[model samples]
Target chain A: MIKRKRRIETFSFFDHTGICKHLEKMAVKGWMIERLTNFGWIYRRIEPKNIKFEISYYPKASEFDPEPSDDQKTFHEFCAHTGWKLACTCAQLQIFYNELENPIPIETEPTLEVQTIHASAKKSFIPAYILLLILSVLQCFFLVSGLLGDPIDTLSNTAKLFSTVCFFILLIICTVELCCYFSWYGKAKRRQSKVSFINRQAHLFYRKLSLLL
Target chain B: MPRAKFQTLTEQMFYILLCLKDECYGLDILDKVPSMTAGRVNVGSGTLYNLLEQFLDAQIIRETKVEGRRRTYILTEKGKDMLKKEYERINAQVTDYKNIFEKEEIV
Candidate 1:
């Protein structure tokens, strides 16, 4: 009988302790774990058979100054050793690995600006709609108060009645606008969360699948 | 303290306890295991976190310290006992399997 040994691949990344927390969370579901030391800094890996892999984490980069500290140089060397492609002078590090079962080349496009605009529009709409609703209520109050009073003269009284009726009509229009805003706001938020969750799950699945292949 | 022993634990929970046998943070354990096993297992952040909460609840592991907002974990006495018993059980199973195979060859 021929016994087949499973082929395992290894990938490493240098990142902060937080990334470790993310992996440890996954390890509880039966993924194997190991820590490796190259130099003084530690590297980590998560091995799951028959899974695609992805590793994403931030790494510490040193400050740029006239005179650099030894600590800064050391940090750069550590980041280089840990397979960090990009370095930022940030405290937290994130590293992630996904098994490449279905290897799809990532396409880079300018999306941040578009996303920012959409986010701002959504945020602006929420408050504007709320304000409109409030104004509508206030207008109704003025109209009600005016109707309860007798103006000093017939002309003034007639004018007050006309103004009160106009306010009521405007209030109805604003109320409708507020309702539309709320529906739009709720749908946008729900869709955003759903899309985010699905994207995460897909990334995870691909990462795991990469390991298997 | 004697490590708390469990009659059974899910494979992930056992591996987590085993991973914490030494000083480790979340990412360290994540990277260590996959390479050690040659990528035979990978744990994702969501699953790893939920299990950590369970182990903390079970008193198997405790957060030792925070380094710049990251929590490091060390096994508690009860956790050690649980790991020890698990190791013993696995060793026994391996031995039993080896003996069975050897006897079958002789026959």
Candidate 2:
């Protein structure tokens, strides 16, 4: 018989250390992360064991790619030769595990690791936030114009009222997400010292939401 | 862009470039670094892998050959110059360590 559990995975893009520590704890409890789902991570029961986890950002990798590209394959092979076994991957984040005692950590050069993370985020959240900002701005422009042009009719009509409420919700969400991204980025840029992200509480909220689902 | 800052590379970066001074496969570096440093320094695979990519991008190293799953790399001219500068910088630091043995010496 196989026992399994689903838990929301909390990984603030900058808090790689936190996620790795979380996984290490899970391993201590005999739960190994089996797969990533839309909501969170699903774990399968296993023998309680100590394992070292490492994460790397592969900017060139795509989740949609049918097969590992030649460069990625070669890179993995090199890591394998060094005793780190590939565990799982989500999008561009590659995770590896090692059962060996006190293995050397994957990220050695602190400044380079920080630089690589910034480069990856440039390709990801920066564009996402910008697009969201543009969309919400357009949404606000239309809704505000309509309200001002004909105050009585705009407030009287249910359709316009519904859209006004929807746009406001979107605006709030976009603003919050942008703030969260930049705040974390700024703190993470300092590097070296272990940094905790402010979005941890927000992530815990999502984890609870995922648990219900 | 301060030339002096970059002219001095981290221990791992210095050793990685030194390892590629001889044409060798990527995997070979995994073992070579520890052995050369007499176990004092260890370069993790992920660290080494990413460093190799950065080196390739910066033209510090070039892929010499690919044999099946293993790819060999060698230092380029730019890499050699950088490595030489780093070597000289470290030597200069040791040469300047005249006050550590004498407490009376002041900056």
Candidate 3:
């Protein structure tokens, strides 16, 4: 009689795009996905390999937590109960695992360029807000100065004209700001969300690998 | 007057803390929880992010910006201590439940 053992395989990837692609590839290769952890930055893929089964766990350097603090310990305990592991660091591309521990070295490549992109994305909103504020103040000033016309008859008409122009300008600025804010916020948030999903997946895979080891 | 101690956290808070333990971001928590629980628990981005902000206020987790538009989370010492206590308490409960079942079987 032959004994068959259940094989649980887990793998992690730093590149979110790559992780997604790898999952697709695994699906084609007849690997059944058992679990996934989506951390928004990386993903952990747990699959059933051949009868022998293999668990592949990778970590991104960006999400690596070197020291577990009290809160982190609680978090880990929660995750452990749920059978999940911490995701990889963002700076890491590959992962090395051993019994009881997985160590990922920090990536040396400069990430300032990426940071600059995020910084600029946030800073861009300031100018838009400032422009709107200026327009609003100017409109208020024009109305208060009573420069549009005479006290009674012309004042109302002139004020109407000035107010109309101000209103239109304000409307345009507000519309643009609203649209830009949503677009910027959406794109930035979506990217962040995707990365986080991947990160959580990576963590899940790491935990599975730990069990296998 | 002394404040009353709560035995369990709100579901949102519990999930948020669970998300942060693994260095997750606000958005990541938003995406992960629903799928993790097989759609039984769905946490929207707004609610999850707010919960993370609260955790930050409570000093349970801290945020770190590592990549573009990515803010990662790490648990604080206080958070870990709380988590350890919670784990012990829960483990004790599970043990008690198991013992009860075992006693019934023996009887």
User: What DockQ does predicted model 1 obtain?
Assistant: 0.03
Give the candidate number with the greatest lDDT: 2
Q: Evaluate model 1: give its lDDT.
A: 0.46
Instruction: Output the worst ten-in-a-row residue range by lDDT, candidate 2 chain B.
Output: B1-10
If the candidates were sorted by their lDDT against the true structure, best first, what order would they fall in?
A: 2, 1, 3
| Alpha-carbon deviation at B84 in model 1, angstroms | 0.8
The regions of model 2 sitting more than 4 angstroms off are A10-14, A152-170, A191-213, B1-5, B99-107
Q: Which ten contiguous residues of candidate 2 chain A have the minimum total lDDT? A: A204-213
* Candidate 2: docking tier: medium
> How would you encode candidate 3's per-residue C-alpha lDDT over B12-100 as one tens digit per residue?
55556776677776556755776677766655332343345556788888877656445688788877776777778778989999999
Q: Which stretches of candidate 3 lie over 4 Å from their true place?
A: A1-213, B1-7, B66-70
List iRMS for all predictions.
14.8, 3.0, 17.2
Q: Write the per-residue lDDT of candidate 2 for residues A95-181, one digit (tens) a residue.
A: 788888987777676666666666776777567777877887887788779778987887788886786667666666557656766
Tens-digit lDDT string for candidate 3 (A1-213)? 212223433432223343545544553454433333342223234343322111121111123446544443333333333323333222222121111222111111112212322333344434556677677767656555655444465366865667756655665455544454345444545453322223445455544544443
Ranking, DockQ, top scorer first: 2, 3, 1
Error of 2 at A102 (Å): 1.2
